[model samples]
Target: MSEEELNARHAEKMKKKKAARDKILATKTIEKGLLIVHTGKGKGKSTAAFGLVFRALGNGLKVGVVQFVKGKWETGERKILEHFPEQVTMTAMGDGFTWETQDRQRDIEAAKAAWERAKAMIMDEEHQMVLLDEMNIVLRYDYLDIADVIEFLKTKPADKHVIVTGRNAKDELIELADLVTEMEMVKHPFRAGVKAQKGIEF
Candidate 1:
């Protein structure tokens, strides 16, 4: 086959695959939400959560993102997310980081505010997916009520998908999660005295 013919054949194959997936999904008729937790001592929790965001967006789903304790917008994801303000909404806690905040009480207040935003998103069924960035650490730091958060999440709209990402996800959160991934840090460049790099690690 010619190159163009091969390309057309590949496109047709993909179309068939998508059609099959749609058929199976329609037959199942499972109308419910998903609770996902990404946590551990390792890394990429937020990255994993954002990957879900991209997937949801690809499927034409609206997403709400609230970043707990990430006060700034210098990261690569932030830059891309900003371009899609209509499809993706984001709010960041005003504290630079946990250790840099200095004022513990004030940091807690910031985290609480971020949680409030996430709370609203969880309750809003209009949003197909809600991403609570680093919220696990916020709850672990005692900045928000774990019980309240879990209750809100559990009662979320049937089709809503909630993603919570951070280190040290509480036991209650883990129990509530239908899907959970714990990223254990086996080895990192930081251990070898390498600093965080742009585009790749971030």
Candidate 2:
């Protein structure tokens, strides 16, 4: 085909694509909060959740964050969010990972306390988005009752968005979530003897 003919064909194809996309978008009228879950044996689960928090902040929405693990370490996101106290309420409640603590009972207590704070944030009218960082890790260990957590989440305020991130998400939680993402790790630097670095890992 001539160059002019090729240009015309491409334009026609894009026009049809745009029309189809618009039609589908018009049918999606319902707007409400979402129960979003990020889980898998891969990196970037928590990173993705933090990205949503930043997006919410950009839109002038209030956010609440409860970190169930990595509380002892000072993370870059935590430091940045601290500057927006009026729009963000963050609590890092974990003592550290389970192996670091080495006490099952202590881990359970910490999980319980973090859940209490998380529940409060979910119910609080001021917050529009609440991020439950590493919640699945605690759930995987049975540190908190899954039944209770699911029930509470079911009854959360209709206009509030809840985000849970960590590996090994429970079957029940995945079933109840409105949106779920699983990260598949094809490669990672840790396997190549590169330790977790600032800004990249944390």
Candidate 3:
């Protein structure tokens, strides 16, 4: 086809696409807080959750974060979030990963403590968004009662958003969540013997 004909065809296709998208969007009028889950074995689960936290902060929304794991490590996100003391309430409650700690009981205790803090943030009216970092990992290990967690989350305020991030999310939690993202690992540097560098993994 001629260049002019090709350009005209593309413009016609795009016009139709925009009209269809606008029609579909018109049906989505209801606005409410969301229960979002980021799960799977991929590397960016927690990273994606932090991105949302940053977006919420940019919008002047108060955020509360409960780190269920990696509490011992000093992460770049944590350092930057700490600077926003007035808008962010963050608690790193985990001792470390279960394998590193090598104590099932200690891990359970730490998970419980973190869950308590998470519940408080979910219940608090001031916090518009709450991030439960590595929550699925604890849930996978059965460190906390899944039933109780689901029930508590069900009762969260209508206008409060909750984001949970970790691998192997439970079926029950996935069913209850309004949005669920499973990150599929296509390739990873860790598998190729590349150590996690600062500002990328942390």
Highest lDDT scorer = 2
- Name the regions of candidate 2 deviating beyond 4 angstroms: 71-74
lDDT of 2 by residue, 1-202 (tens): 9999999999999999999999999999988899999999888898899999999998999999998986544468878888788999988766687888888888899899999999999998999999999999999899999999999999999999999999999999999999999998989988899987887876
CA lDDT of each prediction against the hidden true structure: 0.84, 0.91, 0.90
TM-score of each: 0.81, 0.95, 0.95
lDDT of 2: 0.91
Tens digit per residue, CA lDDT, model 3, 20-47: 9999999999889999999988878888
- Residue 195 of candidate 1: its Cα lDDT? 78
lDDT of 1 by residue, 9-128 (tens): 999999999999999988987667889999998878888899899888777889999988674334888877776777887888875667887888888888877778887887876688
